[model samples]
Target: MSDDNGLPGAQTRRALLAGAGAVGAAVVLAACGGDEDPAGPGSAAPTAPDGSGEPGAADVVVRAADVPVGGGVILASKGVVVTQPTAGVFKGFSPICTHQRCPVSAVDGGTINCTCHNSRFSIEDGSVRSGPATQPLPAKEIVVDGDRISLA
Candidate 1:
């Protein structure tokens, strides 16, 4: 016997069950494996804008002593590198490497180096100083407000 839809009752029930199972499988697959949330644990919080009117720039600070002439250091807590390639000049860039999204492991001799894939970036302008990184690190707008630096 067929129901109003013209399919046998058992056939209709089977079809419904198959459809439900397919949906369930899809849901499971979606939740199985993927990249971790960018803001999850071990990830730094987004930087606050330094009010410089530049989009995506975040407010951040670096101790005048933390940066030295012709040198730089990565601020792991803020996901940025503060540099002073020359006396009285300061530059900031995202510490997260552009190549593989890995946090820069160190900065030496005005170069920001990512240990993950051996990518290196310049502290002067955040340009790609080496490979396998092809893109420059993003620079953040920074303002020296008194003894503190505000990022924008």
Candidate 2:
């Protein structure tokens, strides 16, 4: 009773529809991801190179006094973690973990920790301090203007 195509008309039609649905879903996923977090669902609003929210915008991340020497602060809105590795040096990196694109949970004990998979990255250079991630965190430049901090 089957046609020369080796399947009934309804079965062949159903198979084609299933394949099309899968392709459509993949396209939808690809369109949503552009840059910043390539494979992530998305990230916070774009953080400008100067860390300003927008043009003519000068965003002050935090007071210099707020960041502890040898420690850092997580500016969620800016999607950056600023670390003061030494007495007066500040470093910035994307908080998204390279392990699985999870937002880094915290910087503690001199490492950035991701709660999702227990991956760790050094606070000093964003190098992987633990496994499940081989690539270091992506660095972002910032400038310390006296007591103010902004993307550079």
Top model by lDDT, which number? 2
Error of 1 at 84 (Å): 0.6
Per-residue lDDT for 14 in model 2?
Answer: 80
Write the residue-wise lDDT of candidate 2 on 1-152 in tens digits: 55435744877788899999999999999888755565456656666555657642456676677788878888878889999888888889998999789898888888888899999888899999897988999997888888778777
Per-residue alpha-carbon lDDT of model 1 for 29-141, expressed as tens digits?
98886777746788755445555454334444665676777888778787668888888888889989999899999888679999999998988999998999999999977
lDDT per model vs. reference: 0.79, 0.82
Q: Highest TM-score: which candidate?
A: 2
Error of 2 at 11 (Å): 51
- Please list the residue runs of candidate 1 whose C-alpha ends up more than 4 Å from where it truly belongs after superposition: 1-60
Residue 93 displacement (Å), model 2? 0.6
> What's the CA RMSD for each of the models?
12.3, 10.4
